[model samples]
Target chain A: MALLEVKDLKVRVEEREILHGLTLTVNEGEIHAIMGPNGSGKSTLSHVIAGKPGYEVTDGQILFKGEDLLEMAPEERAAKGVFLAFQYPVEIPGVTTMNFLRTALNAQRKARGESELMVPDFLKKVREVSKSLNIPQDMLKRGVNVGFSGGEKKRNEVLQMALFEPSLCILDEMDSGLDIDALRIAADGVNALHSPKRAMVVITHYQRLLNYIVPDVVHVMSKGRVVKSGGKELALELEESGYTQFEDAA
Target chain B: MNVAVAKTGSGRAVSDLFASAEGRLPGSPSVIASRREAFETYERLGLPHRRIEEWKYTDLRALVGEVLPLAAAPDAAALKRAADAVKAHAIAGARKLVLVDGVFAADLSDVRALTAEAGFRTLRETLEKDAGLLTTASTDAVIALNAAMATDGVVLSIADGAQLSAPIQIIHIATAASASAFTRSQVVIGKGARATLVESFVAAGAKAYQVNDAVIVTVGDDADVAHIRLMDDAPDAVNVTSHFVTVGANVKLNFFNMTTGAAVSRLQGLITLAGEGSELSANGVNLLQKTEHGDTTLVVDHAVPNCVSREVFRAVIDDRAHSVFQGRIIVRPDAQKTDGKMMTRALLLSDEAEADNKPELEIFADDVSCGHGATSGALDDSLLFYLKARGLPEKQAQALLIQAFVGEAVEQIADDGLREHVIGIAERWLERRS
Candidate 1:
């Protein structure tokens, strides 16, 4: 069975249909990249899939592990191993990165009937993950992304994906605002999460990020539906030929 | 309605009580005639109330309906015990001062250098010099109402350039009921000195109601003082709170008040940036449940130039509880570069909960950044759903989000111990409800 199965799913934001009868199925152990131009509803697809507020699933349905996805809340979706690395991560003030991450992790563990980790043990893991991301331990104590630079915000999002180790990760504009060094670190974070049992949907506008975490399937999302699905070579062809060809085809 | 006032024969007794409360002046312990003159000033200024624009939200008319009695001599044994408990149980980093019925307990308190010079005396000494202090006690209507009412208070002073390494805490315990207690305290953080005063007013268990009055604190030039008041009086207690603060040239003061107890509580703070380049930041967090009614009305007057003022208030009200936050930030015409920001956000924890947030900014100067905002609403279901979807139980998710919301204010507390203490209280409250 596919890890995620979307059958003719329709979604709306503020009564405006953003996802019109879209269908896509992803099996475990595969990395899929959804590439599209601006206003192609890429970000909206990710947010709606994560159950963000104000986005209504009007028709059809989404099945995660054969269970209805639309009925769940955003946090519940997260606990179910559906992670959305927001293109623009919300800055929640007065909430320390350490506190938020710990709460999120323990929450998932408790749901799976797992034993809670001690503070010291959790702190140790946090320190290790932070160091791997080149994030200082001090930043963990500061409010989440309050004073972070643009690149830092993207890196922070990647760090969360790595820490949670979600089963299905969706990267939204992960390459935007990243410097060359930051870009490598971000790609490395995603690459580390790659496994046969896990799946990822990398959403981006440019072919720049695809070079690092090459997707098994490259899907072009335009005007709400996935217009075309092709192998990795299609990304190169599109990069060289530009998306105008798809716009014409649509 | 008019709950505080009692009928005296046929006339309204409130005006009469305050006029006497007003006539009573500077607690003159001194026999000298000059001391009498200062008392005259107290008479002239009179006791302020809701009729006064600044005191509108806090209706003390009913609060001062009955005349309060002068505080009885403190329960010496109980005062000492409370003092010992604080010293041993507090955040080991706290410097404590014990006051029974508003009178400083020398044997129980730890105020260094105050005994040697600067002619600083205890509240007891202040009373001796100012005989009128006791007469006007709760009777001045404010303190006269408090003296006529409060049991005791603590007098404190921080010398020039002397920075206390720990938070100085004043502990006031009331042992009487029915009769009110008027407690008066004066705290002076001298020039260039940095200190923090934490006043905890916890009443000794009692059945009758108690009224508390206190006016203490003067921050000097270039001085920095962080004043925190945690009012956790008895549930049956009826409190009328008032505190006056004056900050000198280039001084910075951060004042916070948290009221988690009392039947009906009203707190008022009058802050003045008395000199140039001074700053005052006042923040309050009120968590009221049941039918509890709490009000925090404040005035931050920027009388000098190059000074800044910021005030933010947050509240979590549940059940039929009511809360009011009336804040006024005034930038006088000559007060330039006055950056004042005020925000009040509240969460209606239940359908019956009520909250009134009044944010006012009166800026007379053109070169000033003054803005104010007020917001009140129920918990955001999406945020709650987000947390619950994260696998947390419905109650746990709600609790976590609530904690984070309140944590926004608690994180600003500089002292980690105090910050943790506040979070612990919030966490406990959430746990109980969950």
Candidate 2:
């Protein structure tokens, strides 16, 4: 059985349909990279899977672990081990990053009927995860993503992904606005979270990010659906041929 | 010319109460005369209604209905209740000055210790000796009423160069329900003195009461002070507090107010930068729920050159509550190089909840930099979704966002413990909301 299965997923925003008949499947332990140009519905697919509000699912169904994924709230899906790294992380003033992480982690645990983590243990875990992501301890003390540099924000998202340890991870344009140094650092954090029991769907427009966190399979998305799917070499092929071909082919 | 206007029911009730209570009120002959003059002013102005520009949003005549009679002197049981309330609301390491039923409770206050550091006197005692203390230049009807009917309050005067090690907590506890309490207090900080003052208004088993309180604060040259007011009255109480503050040269005044309780309450501030080089950071938060209505109106007068002022007010309204903020900054004609900025924001949690934000600026100086902004909105959907995606439930997500919204203004408290205490109050409000 697939970890995530989207059957003819059609998502509409207001009067416009953004994801038209998009279908895909991800099995456990596989790292799939979905490469696409802007407005190709890569983000819309991630948002719909995460159950963001305002995107109406006009048709189709999503299954996770053989359960109806679309029927759950975003938090419920998150508790069931689904995570989406936001393309543009929000700046929530007055809530420290450390506090947000603990609240989120505990909420998920509580939802899964697990005991809450002790303060010392939670702090230790956050310190270890953040240190590896090159996030300074002071950054944790500051407001979540407030006044953070672009690279810092991306790294913060990766830090959450590492701590969450979700089964299915969807990274939507995580490499945007990141310098090469920051990109490599964020990619390393994501790579360190890879596990045989985990599945990841990395969405990006450029192949540069694929260099650090290589994928097992690559899918080309154009006109709201996948136009082609192949091995890791497919990313390089798209980089060489450009998305215009895939756009025309679709 | 005095225009003929009919007095409201509440206004007429207050006048009768004043006439009956005048003999027992503490004051000298001249003070009594001043009180009579003040009462005449109130008679002419009547209760402020929607027609008055400053009282546009808050119609005191309608909301107050009929004013309750003055609260009687605290008896033994009332004193015990007030003591329990002080214990519950006291700030650690601060000297407590407790006022029960609008009268200073010497037994409950740290009077001996406070007097050693500053000039301490009850308003009752001060008015008996000093007749001029009863006179007020304010023309507002509510303030005039306070001047006429005030029974007792604190008169604290910090000496020059006095650095107080602990804060002075003034706790006003109402021990009688279905009655009114009118008190006026004053605090004078001399040159180079540093202090923190906390004024808390709470009730001890009291409801459906009325509180008319006023505090006059004077910050001298080079003095640094932080004034924090927490208004947690009874659920059915009506509270009105007027703050008159004057800052001197090179002074740093951090003023913060949090309103969480009361059926209908208004916290109005008239702060003046009277000397050059003074800085004022005035911030407030209004957390109202149910049918509560809270209004925070401030007028910051820049009367000198080279002074700076910043006012940030945040309000979170839930259920059918209404919150209003009116911030006005005035730069005097001769006050050049005055830097003033004001921002007020409101977040509505329910469809029936309402918020009104008005930020006004009157600039007469050509070279001053003055700006004001106001915004009222619901919580951002994208922000909420972002939190939910991270595993917070809908209610918890909303609470976190609401906290963050008001936390911006609560952070203006210079002290960490006070900040935490204010945050705890906000958390409890959120808990009740959920």
Candidate 3:
């Protein structure tokens, strides 16, 4: 069975429908990329999976590890090993990255009946993880995402995912506003943290990020639903040809 | 509305209280005599009433028109226990200034670091001294009242350019039935010095207690002073704390009032940017419930050129609770190049909860940038739905969103430990409310 399975999902935001009918399955260790234009519901798909508020699942079911995932809470979903890298990470001032990360990690750990990580041990592990992502240790002491550059904020999200070590990580427009160097750095950070026990859903408008962290499956999403599924080469074809064809097809 | 009309009543109440408190002081006759005159004047003026335009929204008259006589404290043992309990809740590692039942508890407070030569003294000592230190009338009615009636408070002074590593916690605990307690604190930061102060008022097992508190702070050239108030008491409690701060050239001053108590709790700041290049930041976080009302008001004056002032206040009102914020930024004609910004935001969690915000920018200088805005709204269903989609319970998601909303103001606070403590308080409040 797949690690995450969504069968005939129908989601709505407000009275208007955003996701009419969507179905997908992600097996462990596979990286799937969803490419689409603006208003394609790509971000909505990622947000819904991560349990963001506003978008409602009106029908169908989402099963994660054989359990009904749609019924769980956001933090519960997080504790169950799902992480969402927000398209626009909210800036939470007064909460240092270190403190927030520690709280989130301990919350997840405690939910699983695990012992609390010692402050020193946790700090050491965080520092190590940040170093691998090329994020400055000084930034970790600052407020979460406050005054962070676009790329820095994106990298911070990946850093959080790495520290949390979730089973399924959703990246929402992780490549937007990233320069060439930052794109490589962020993609490398995600690639380094990838493991056989983890599955990832990457949402993007462009195919640039795929160059660094190539995906095993690619899907074309438009008007709130995925219309086509293919391999990595499909991304290059769409990138070179533009979304004119897929926009009509989807 | 004209705040000047209410000035008279506020002055009278202030004078009466000052005289009543100072009359009992055992001190040099000379200092006492002058204070006595001021007290007489304060009593004649009395606390301001709502009929007065300036005091309209506050309605201080209603809060204290009855003038509950200041009752003597309860048993000494109980008062001492309350002080000890307060000492435990103080900002960790910060110096403690404990006031039990309206009187300074010397044993519970740390006085070893204080010195008369350094301008640090208890209100008692200041009264006995020949020093001609007196308070002048201002727009703040509460200040006059506090100055006239304050029975006990603190005098904190940092030497020129001395940086204090730890925050200072002034703990006021009132454990009395049918009693009124008054607290006053005076703080002076010398040139280039830096310090953070936390004023905590916690009431324990008190029935119908009234606390009138006041704090006066002065920051010298290049000095930085941060004042944080953490108030957690029963809903029957009544508290009115006023802060008067004067900033010298190049000094930086911040006042943060976080209140979570009382049937009617009002905190106000009367700040004066007296010298060029001075800066002031005033912020407040008020979380209220039931028919509770919490008011955070300020009157900021830019008396000198190149002065800067920033004010941000956020409130979360649930049930039938109410939160009021009235901020006034006045830039004088000669105070050119002054930059002042004020923003007050409120989150109404319940339909019955109400918020009143009046932010004014009075600019007399052509080169000044001063503006104020106030916004009030309930939790957006859209934001809530986003969190719910992630599998969070509706209540928990609302809590997170509420925390995030207020966190905007909290992030500006510089102290890490205190920030976390306030966040913890927010979390606890949300859990109880939820």
DockQ of 2: 0.76
What would the per-residue lDDT of candidate 1 be over residues B241-329, giving only the tens digit for each residue?
A: 77778889988788888777676787877787879888777888887877778888888888878888878788888888888898888
- On a 0 to 100 scale, what is the lDDT of residue B386 in model 3? 38
Query: Which regions in candidate 2 have their CA more than 4 angstroms from the true location?
Result: A240-250, B1-4, B8-14
B-chain TM-score of model 3 = 0.89
lDDT per prediction?
A: 0.72, 0.91, 0.78
lDDT of 2 by residue, B92-163 (tens): 888999999899999999988888888899999999876566666688988988888899999999999999
TM-score of chain B of 1: 0.82
Pick the DockQ winner.
2
Q: Model 1: what TM-score for its first chain? A: 0.96
- Please give, for residues A1-250, the per-residue lDDT of candidate 1 as tens digits: 5989988878888778888888888889899989888877888788777876777888888889888888876667777888888777666566678887788788877766788778999888888877887888888888778798777777787777777778899888998888878898878878987999999999999888999999999999887788899998878887898888787766
Native-to-model Cα distance after best TM-score fit, residue B48 in candidate 1, in Å: 8.8
Model 1, residue B212: C-alpha shift (Å)? 2.1
Model 3, span B184-207: residue lDDT tens: 778888899988888888876776
Q: Give the higher-DockQ candidate: 1 or 3.
A: 1
